[model samples]
Target chain A: MSENKKSVFNEIIRPALVLTVITLVTALCLALTNAGTKEVIKANAEKELLRSKQEILPAAEAFSEEKEEELNGKTFKYIEGTDASGEIVGYIFQNSTPGYNGPVTALVAIDTEGKIVDVNALDLNETPNVGMLVGERDFLDQFAGHSGEIALTKEKAAENEVQAVTGATISSAAFLNSVNEGLAQYAAVSGNAPEPLSPEEQACPDAAEFSEEKTVEKDGNTYTYKEALGEDGSLIAYIIRTESKGYHAPVIVLTAIDPDGTIQGTATVDLQETPNLGSKIGEEEFMQQFVGKSSEISLGTLSDTSVEAVSNATISSKAFVDAVNQALELFPLVSGGAS
Target chain B: MSTDKAKVKEVFTRGLIRENPIFRLVLGMCSSLAVSTTLIGALGMSVSVLVVLICSNIVISLLRNFIPNTVRIPAYITVIAGFVTIVQMVIKAFFPEIDGLLGIYLPLIVVNCIILGRAEAFANKNGVLISALDGLSMGLGYTIAMISIAFIRELLGSGTLFGVQVIPASIPPIMLFALPAGGFLVLGILMAVCNRIAEHFGQPKAELGCDSCAAYGRCPAKEFEASQDEAQTDADRKIRKAGARAKRNEEDRK
Candidate 1:
């Protein structure tokens, strides 16, 4: 019996039996622990969510219980924020969007006036020192007390323009998308489904294919380029966007180049150039100067005229011409429309 | 009574300095380096490990006779992982802050070689009381090592101790100390300091990491197999008997 047990039975069966006993006892202990802590864990998670909602909507003293709904194939939880008088003041919702490095989640608060009260990113994890800066004060503060259609810009424009974190456009866009998701969810809940976007509201609204982001380096400045495919899958146009020094803040221009390498059109997308003087770059007469010019188009002296500079707004005119020149230089790369 | 007390004291206190888990023995370096960035994190991890180690030690010691040597590792694992889960649940319930600080490392204590080493080397050979004391003292040694590293890292990296501003505002904290590279730098310097002090006291040089484990140079786990000698046991005897009966029946038919 001793020999039999030593050879096989003791080695396998006995060990298995002992291990089974240990595992069974361990399982019982863990089951007890789970039973004891299950409710507290749930409570802690709920309490954390509530605190986040309160922070996003600072003016709201209290919040209603979560109202869950399915929108765009994602589950959204919305809580109504109430004031001291118990009157519903705003709605806060959490939204998660794919960020540059990971999934970005944020709590968005929009008041009764359809203005974004604030946005608070929850446990943001993005590329540190760059993309992660979206959760910082300077970037997030841009969302406060804003109304109307909101968009990010590097330069300056009129109503509802927020400056994005420089060099972190993707992460900033993720944050913006997070807020937009919340807005869409809230709009659905309030039965205020927004109208479908107009053609102009779409990026390259008339194009067949979506934009493939590209960039060009010139004169110590980076010109962001987006290319679209025309109907029947041909290279359509290259839209060059760049920021250049103007009378005040930087003037931002979007210059379009045809596949054959000539300027299709120029638009002053956003500029903080001085009003009436430097702002003339956005006007048709000033932008028209480079409509047919190629990469050869240079900002002529104030009077010397190949493409005449904007009178008294030379700096702003130079900014416009610089964008067109960047387009002209980049046109060859995508000239065959194969890129 | 006095001699008995001294024996208990010697067995327990040996783990504190002579066989210190982190500084001298250097087992479980992964968790020590990862979570020692903040004092709170260090303290939280240490206490969690303390509970699991002590409990697992006592359990393994009590079951020493019942567990076979060949399958002891797997059995030890089951016991250790069980305690770690319980620790995780308790921390999640009552100490959510520590739960967040320790993150994945809390449950990772199951794989910590320190606990496994002690179980195989000391617990399985000793009584429950002696094993528990070993676990306590070793856990304390690990906790002290973690706290020392965290104290230095936090103080220099953030210019704060336990999240409170300590250094004057004018002295900007060195940002590198908060990073993983800084963790390695601090641990290396502290280890050197520890070894130098040990050498001054006439102690042999301590091995780093699992090398110090008693089972370090032993055969791999596959050696636990019974293939070393295929001695005919009861099953082989049954096969041999069945073969003889078949041969005899064939002879009678012929």
Candidate 2:
């Protein structure tokens, strides 16, 4: 009789019974936890959102949800920032734009005067130092105090344009585009043109004042190339000066382009980079590789090119390439003068 | 009482170093490799595993008597998943940053071999309190291994500790240390160092590969038996060949 009972328990009931019991108990535990945490989670999310809203619009004491619009299946949220006395200070618009690897969402705040108060990059999955450089204070600050239809350029950022992050131009462009979308939405509702760049910050540093130079248009802006005279008073080679943002600081390279469009020499005008790593870019062996290469040498880790980047200093290497490419673009225009 | 104390101590200490889940046992390596990129990520993952492991062990040990051998695996899996779900909900609600960092790996802990292996090999056979103790020790061991690897990766990859800049500005961080390849390289070197240390202590370095692994007891293939059978057959063939050679020699003499 006992064996018969055991067989029944073993054959049919036990497996189903045990699994059912375990699943029910688990479900009970999870339900209890969910009950306790649900409200706290909601509150935490709201609190975080409010805190970020206040952070970009510091002048405003409170904010009101203005309106939201759906474009291309993405929600663009806009809020009206009000002062302590309940006066409208600025409008904060949140938008997400697809970046190099992923979508980067940004908060762009424009005051009543239509000038940008501040721009903050919120949720972003870009690579930490490469694409996420948009989070840097200096990079974000470039957007503040600017107005009008936002444009991103690699050139020295004039009043109307923002400079792209070196080696992360795509991400920078994406970040700028997200902000531009926010501004565009704000304009669509209010029908106000974006304020132009302020006059005080309009003058870009004069590259031509240093020497006799020839200006040529490359991607969008004019870059200057000058002739370097040897001790005998004859033209040695054309010098193209360009700057690249490195891991620590901007690396400026002056490349000498020969008449045949080959690189003659390269010199580091300014490089306050990390020692043993970014400093490798300035090493004789690394810079010498660019000397005989054509001005059009493609620069990347995977690309088949004559120049190889330093082992751990890929950012610095790319920056060096950008500076070299700037010089290359100047080569064809000045090839006649050098010859 | 003294022998009992010794046995308990042995169980606990074995997990801490002798059978570290990540380095010594090489279990739960998928999460370890993915989440050790940052110190906080490692800590969050370790805590999640700890919660699931302890809870599952206690439940399994308590239900050991009624659970039929035929349904043991499924029962253990349900218990583990229950705990894992609880952990996931708690983390998502309270520690959302960690939830984001761990991503799907937090849920994937249900399938981590260590938790189920313990349920089958240790928890089901042990008393509830002892099973819980075993789970805690194993989780701690895994946590320590994760922190050690993460410490190096975070420092070298981002030049930061706990997301703070501790390395001086002069040192350029090696980006490779933050990538997936760095995880594998660091894990390998750490395993080798641990083996060396274990050998130094006269604990024969843990047996290599899955055949001798403790987890293999639960493996459906019964791989350990197959390996044993292969060895026995090889031995039997050698003995038979020896007998044939001896017989040939005797016949020649005759």
Relative to the unseen true structure, what is the C-alpha lDDT of residue A45 in candidate 2, on a scale of 0 to 100?
85
Q: Rounded to one decimal, what is candidate 1's iRMSD?
A: 1.9
lDDT of each: 0.79, 0.81
Q: On residues A1-339, what C-alpha lDDT tens digit does candidate 2 reach at each position? A: 999999997788878887788778788988898898888888878888888888899999999976776554556668999998999999999778788777888899999877889999887777766787788887898988876678988889987799988888888988998888877776754666445422111111111222476666767877666665555555556777778788888888878765566677787765777899989887777887776677476655433354788998889888888888877876776675444
Interface RMSD of each: 1.9, 1.8
The superposed Cα distance between candidate 2 and the true structure at residue B177, in angstroms, equals 1.3
Segments in model 1 whose C-alpha atoms lie over 4 Å from true places: A1-8, A59-77, A83-87, A98-101, A125-142, A148-177, A183-194, A197-339, B1-7, B168-171, B206-254
Candidate 1 per-residue C-alpha lDDT over B1-254 given as tens digits, one digit per residue, 9 for 90 to 100: 99979989877766666667887777999999889878999999999888989999999999999888888999999999999998898889899889888988998999999999889888998999989998998899898899999999899987889989899858977767877788899988887787777666556655654433433443243243345334436668789999999999999999
User: What does candidate 2's lDDT look like per residue over B105-208, in tens digits?
Assistant: 99999999989978987999999999999999999999999999999999998899888998985897887888788889999999889877767766654565
True-structure lDDT of candidate 2: 0.81
lDDT value for candidate 1?
Answer: 0.79
Provide the lDDT at B230 for model 1.
46
Q: Estimate TM-scores for all models.
A: 0.64, 0.68
